[model samples]
Target: MTLDLPLIWAGLIAFAVLAYVVLDGFDLGVGILFPLIRGEPHRDEAMNSVAPVWDGNETWLVLGGGGLLAVFPLAYAIIMSALYVPIIVMLLALVFRGVAFEFRWKTQRGKFLWDWSFAAGSTLAAFAQGVALGALVQGIPVANRAYAGGWWDWLTPFSILTGFALVIGYALLGATWLIWKTEGHVQRRAYDIAFWVAPATLLLIGVVSLWTPFLSGPYMARWFAWPQVLLVAVVPLAVLGAGFLLIRGLTERREIAPFLASLLLFVLCFIGLGISFFPHLVPNSVTIWEAAAPDNSLSFLLVGGVVLIPIILAYTAYAYWVFRGKVNAAGGYH
Candidate 1:
């Protein structure tokens, strides 16, 4: 079968977003869960769990944004323009969180401040991303590929709901990561959080589903239409299965199983969103084909992907392989 460039680009974008969600999701989750962790020892253990992998995980985010800028300039410009404030806030939060991660280890006196910064920054970044997503889904106030509304146009009820939902989602991811990385008290606490957070995340999904049709007219048609509805239904069912598995694993004290199950649930939910917003890159404002860059630019990006993606995968795998053992207080960030 012939390759449709638009579809291919859409798939690439989806892959990048999913990679960001899975890889960076855990670290962001860890940040949000930071406030709940007691004492310096547990905090170090939590930070160490992601130290080697966290920086590398952020690489996909760079690639996703950069690739969009290069390969889909129109969409990039429009999205950035519409989401200017939120994106700026997200970047600042990310920067603050990263700095806190480094400085908290070195500074002895201001540790509490750094901890709050990290957690607050993580929460801020995650919420901004969710709001941006909601705005995109709800269709930005656009005309002629330009934002036609005021600055607060993105701050709808739908966006706020999505913001909180994403926080819960990221927390769930972090809890799973903890289950995989730490042991004893830390692991137990993480498991408990996972058990509780899973239901909340599911509820958020339900709310988004219920709210989408009312907020966007096309959502109901896209979701409930014949064969598409069946495909969409599969995602929620898969999420439920994963949730069940996660709960069972946690109950049985199955160690790594709960984390894996949670990761699967995240992937299923992401897939569902991708399907829900297939052709639209800027929601109803612009389509993938219309927003895409020239074929030459795409070809260039594909070439870079050939070299960069494998290296990223290899390094990530090697890091995980080296850090396979359980996290402990003594596990210093080298």
Candidate 2:
């Protein structure tokens, strides 16, 4: 049986990437919300809420990058090379944030500085990812399995808008998360923040959804095509519904519902993006089959991937399950 190794590898990589985005996304959201909480105790509670799983959450990014490199060397090379600067900035930001989490508690002298570092790092990383996504969606110049565009190509108005949109979106995720993991003043504050941020997030989602279809000719055709259009139409409607649920949950002071609703918005948006791009990894540039490594290479990697990915998922679930509960300010991870 000649299995379509490329297709399998593509699916695996996609799953890894999605896992990274959703899992790490909320924790990063926590960091973004760092400055908003009033007192030291509240901030500590917020930090502890994520401390146990934040490092593990980032493992998905490594898995995604590793899977891409192993399965599709051409796409990996081209995309990474194109996104070198933003990637470096993002990594540096995350590193600083990670260190801040550790060192802030060890010293009282520079705790405030560390807090700002965490917030700045998280915001920068989130914005960088959004910019990278926007740049990819806008399409990079590719020729002969290499980037043909300049470094500045990714720096554009659309990319900036997308970056800010992600900031707001992640902030909403963070606030809703606080609602779930905390109580009293922190929870109430989160509720208040969510009420405003949720609407802005929905507006940005609307703008990005409308703007994205215009950027790619293939996307335009796929989105607007007859019978398919009706089916594709459901994605946006579902996103709107999710947004409404998120707002309602926030207004009603429900704990977990708001987070779940926000998460649904993200999932639907990802699914819509996948539908828009389909077989193209880089959007109208390199295809999965074309960018895929040799079948022998993919087959070797696939074996390792299948065994290891499940282990990662299992441990990630176990960690979340183990740490499940409201974060106590007096009895935090510290």
Candidate 3:
């Protein structure tokens, strides 16, 4: 049987994006919750929790962007043109956070500035990502294979709401992560923050889920249409189940379960998005096959990907394994 190279590439790209979101998201959340964490030691503890893996987590983003450029150039061109502002903002914020990561350890009186920079950068990056997601979900106007929308089209009520949702969601991930990796006051504060943040995050998720369907007829039908709805509609209920686990794990004081449940919630939401955008690289615009590079080009990349993806995975897994377990003030790599 012949392989569907376009479809395969689409799945790979989606997997990379999801990996970036789930992995990088929690660390960003840590930065977003920086203000609530008091004391230099505590803040340092918070940052240290993710210090080992934060930079490595972004590898998936590079893979996703590069894959999109090489494999689906048309979709990349269109989406990039549409989302230049938010995408640029995200990159800048990421840079600021990265700087904060290293510089915060080196400075004395000026360390506070770096701390704030980390928080602001993480919050902005998460919000910008959410806005980009909302804009894409709402749809980009394309005419003659070019972006036909206004510059400010991405700034919408729905997009704003999504932006808030992601910020809160990432914060929840951070809090849960802290609960898993910290102790004493930092852990207590993380639990407290998560106690409120969890519900708030769930509410935002519900709002976004409700708001998503009415954005487009295809989206509505994808989730709500008869027969198919039977399957897609289960996602919300599954989210509720996942929420239950998050709360249950928190209440029971389980270390890892809450974090896993939080991740499950994101995974389910991502699956819903994937389902909604199936077959369309540009969401109701460009089909995957239409947007993909030639088969020969795809095959060339696939060969390299076969070797490179595994190496990346092996290194990533090794990093996490080497640095596994609780990250207290005394322990954990700097």
Best-performing candidate as measured by lDDT? 3
Q: Report the candidate with higher TM-score, 1 versus 2.
A: 2
Total clashes in model 1, counting residue pairs 3 or more apart in sequence or in different chains: 0
Return the TM-score for candidate 1, rounded to 2 decimals: 0.95
- lDDT string for model 2 (226-319, tens) is 9899999999889979988988887788999999998898889889889988888878998989999888898888888889989998999999
Model 3 — TM-score against the truth?
A: 0.98
Which residue pairs clash within candidate 1?
A: none
Q: Which ten residues in a row have the lowest lDDT in candidate 1?
A: 1-10
lDDT of 3 by residue, 1-334 (tens): 9999999999988989999999999999999999999999899889889998999999999999999999999999999999999999999999998998899889998999999999999999999999999999999999998899999999999999999999999999999999988888999999999999999989998888888888888988898888998887788889999999999999998888989999999999999898889879889999999999999999999999889989988999998888887787755642
Residue 98 of model 3 has an lDDT of: 97
| TM-score, candidate number 2 | 0.97
Across 1-334, the per-residue lDDT of candidate 1 in tens digits comes to 6556666767876787889888898899999999988889998899889887888888888988988888888889888888888889998999999999899888889999999999999999999989988877787777877777788888988899999999999998899888877888898889889888978987897888777766665677777888878867887788788878977887888878877887897788777676667678877668899998887777777788778878988988898888787778777533
Q: lDDT (CA) for every model shown?
A: 0.84, 0.88, 0.93
> Which pairs of residues collide in model 2?
none
